[model samples]
Target: MNSFPVTKFYDSGKVHTTDTYYELLQLIDTKNIAFEVPKMGQKLPFDSVLGVQVLNVDSKASDNNDASIVLKAKYGKVSFLLTGDADVAIENTMLPKYDLKSTYLKAGHHGSNTSSSSNFINEVYPMGTVLSYGKDNSYGHPHKEVVSRLTTVKSKIYSTAVSGDVTVTTNGQAHSVSAKAWTPPTTTPTPPSAGTTGKLQVVKKDLSTEIVSIQNVGTTDVAMAGWKLVSVQGNQSFTFPTYTLKAGANVHVTSGPNAKSGGNYLKWTTANIWLNSGDPAKLYDSKGALIHEVK
Candidate 1:
């Protein structure tokens, strides 16, 4: 199992002890497999492997996305961005430091809105986007908004959700996507609008910073008084102040010692309230009616 060098960016103590990692460690001494914890800006020593390169691994961020390793590989003139579930914050940090433009992009976070932000998508300008997710996932992988974002760039999108076991072949000059079950959707589905009430849209959530945004997309202003935003994982609740969210407006909420309320932002004033993965945000009206939920 430890045939090749293993590179990890995070501290060993931070990870829950897993049988897989433990077994790998055992092999290091016996098999002489190299182990390394690469730094953020270090270039992986893969120069002999042609154009494959590890662009960045931002382990400093206190989010799961930071563990994601962004890789770039080229064959002839074609290049691919294999994003391992990196979210928006990681993408933003990489934008200013790396040449992210590519011919193909493996959409981050399984096409979650938190990863394929508009700015990152625009900067990558991929000719094709490959979404890796299971079919009919409970978390709604390959979210409609993310799909729309890629389409706007005129990029051909292929999803494992529909196209099982997708495969892409690339030479230095070109690339192609192929899967026996893959077929373009006859008609694309439209994403839900932000202007819908009782449907508080979770626009952004930064677990590293504990910042979240919810928008009021309804045509009329909606009074947010008594409305509550709850972190399903930690059971943390943020009660809305006496404020009315105007149509097409959104509010930003943060958690920490610097929690403050002003204008369109609210603070939760806590720590470790939001889970980095697989946690839902539930919204309820003053009357205790469940309004919206997102994971």
Candidate 2:
């Protein structure tokens, strides 16, 4: 079995949105893969197998929307940065905060101009920059401006979108890197393309009022209408029952003495809202407005 230490840092002070990482760990728990957590920005034990940390600086508010952390590691004279999706502004703030004399950099934010600032590039002075992106991606990532900037700094560029997986091995001050492509199984199942359709429902409640939301989860658009409230948190759910709903719509109802103050709560709270009274409360949308509500 192989063991490694891993740590993650976030510039934005919020938990991540996905759990796919945890799922991967579960698969390797008893396999040939093992890991531990080492302190951030510090060296591993002399006999250690792996060390991980994040580069987050400044007295910025902690939010998930901020850029990703600036990761650094060293083994002898060779050091590496496994930058996730860090943008330019965050890079500008971070470069001055750390000793970033790295041999390699996992180029920030998929080679977007929003990162890879001139000042940040000079600070890193990376021997090479790695770009990980999907080929023919809809977003047209790895913008030309970013690539040209890296060239002006004379940084060698490698890419996953073109060359595939890049692996680096370091032994003290000496290091080497290699690349290989990852291919899916021949029998792999293909999922549906974009523009499919699914249904989703959201519900929010408080002592003063309750709110309900319905939405589309499918690839296709869904409309809002015909939703109702069937339950509540306060003691007056039964007496103040008059809910209205429409097909392909979301219905939100606020009941009880606290209903008046509910709108203010809606403006700032991260609470979920539902517009119906059912055990498996389902919501359907035939229009594309639900995404707007979410943002």
Considering every candidate listed, which one attains the maximal lDDT?
1
Task: For candidate 2, give the lDDT of residue 281.
Answer: 27
Root-mean-square deviation per candidate? 11.2, 14.0
Q: What are the lDDT scores of the predictions, listed in order?
A: 0.70, 0.49
Sum up the clashes in candidate 1: 8
Best by TM-score: 1
Error of 2 at 85 (Å): 1.3
The residue-by-residue lDDT of candidate 2 on 1-295, one tens digit each, is 1345433212233333223335555545645353543333544343464444467522242432243445687666777887666666667667667777788888776776666777887888887788887775423457677777767778777779878888777776676668642232236334223232335445433322344343333444432222222322110111111222233444344432233324222121222222223222222232322322221
Model 1: per-residue Cα lDDT over 84-144, one tens digit each: 8677777888899888999889998787777799999999999888889877543456667
Q: What overall lDDT, based on C-alpha atoms, would model 1 receive against the true structure?
A: 0.70
Off by over 4 Å in 2: 1-13, 16-53, 57-67, 180-295
157 Cα displacement, candidate 2 (Å): 0.9
Question: Alpha-carbon error at 12 in model 1, in Å?
Answer: 9.6
Summing lDDT over every window of 10 consecutive residues in candidate 2, give the lowest-scoring window.
233-242
